[model samples]
Target: MARVVWHVPVTTSGTGSTTALRLFRLRDGRRCAVGFSSPEALVALLGPDQAHTELGEPALRALTAPLGIDALVVDPRLVAPSVTVPAATQPAAPLAPAPICPAPAVRLQRR
Candidate 1:
């Protein structure tokens, strides 16, 4: 029996036929491969627009191992709300430059 899991698919440039699995980052900045048990699980966290593919556990591990990603996050939950920026109608004005502060001088005395 195959332990099938859902993974987000990332299309490669140049050759449209080639594709790759999307890797995610952990809270500690470590790269990890994310998978979901079902399509509904994937969509719940990544939204319905996310493209996905079903693969076995071994296959997912084999694909990500070479990329230095040994950690696999399954059915992970979103920690923060997704932020969406509104489109700007007009070009906004540039912000003022930050004020520069001079560092204090330190003198060392040799005994």
Candidate 2:
């Protein structure tokens, strides 16, 4: 299971909403984030009274640094990478065959 190392609790104000960053250490030794995501959007999709904790900035930077990622900025006006349907321009890459075990399997009977 993925674990949250650092997070900020999200709370709503009178007319405004507040959200923070989140850093997650994935089960496969990878890191993921939700800082650029909006809590309001999450609530909209998941319905009202949703439960989640936002994350912090410093912790995010620290975690991303080791992975050669300097920062994670959110650009609202950013455009999608592909606008039209995708097509394969080149031949598909080849994959290596699965490795075989060096030792034979061993079985023991229970008493």
Candidate 3:
């Protein structure tokens, strides 16, 4: 039987010697390690700019277990909502004026 290898995304530091595994957060705020079956699959979700390395399931699990991440998401399809910037031609809404309040009177006590 052929061993299955997963493509794991990583971020490289200077000289590429120091690399850190890329991790994602679940909707419930739990951290998870993400992997894909192939390079194409990884690129499809993370874009072409993402760097990845191949690792066996055991290796992937071992790497993340020490970090307290037990969830391993394979070929995850969930994506965050994209941010939209308002056009420059559109005018912003006016701000409301602050409310004016009368100053409180305070009596001073002589010691």
> What are the per-model numbers of colliding residue pairs?
0, 3, 0
Give per-residue CA lDDT, model 3, range 1-111, as digits (tens): 999999999999979789899999999999999889999999988899999999998999999999998999998995779889877996879988989988999999999
Candidate ordering by lDDT (highest first): 3, 1, 2
Candidate 2 lDDT by residue in tens digits, 1-111: 664433232345566665433444344546544343566655554346745655566676675577665535431222337578789899988988989979978899999
Residue pairs that clash (backbone atoms under 3 angstroms), model 2 = 8-54, 21-55, 22-55
Worst 10 residues of 1 by lDDT: 2-11
Least well predicted 10-residue stretch by lDDT in candidate 2: 71-80
| Candidate 1: clashing pairs of residues | none
Of candidate 3, the 10-residue stretch with the lowest lDDT total is 78-87
- Most accurate candidate by TM-score: 3
Measured on C-alpha atoms, candidate 2 has an lDDT of: 0.52
Output candidate 1 Cα RMSD: 9.4
Q: Scored by CA lDDT, what does every candidate get?
A: 0.81, 0.52, 0.92
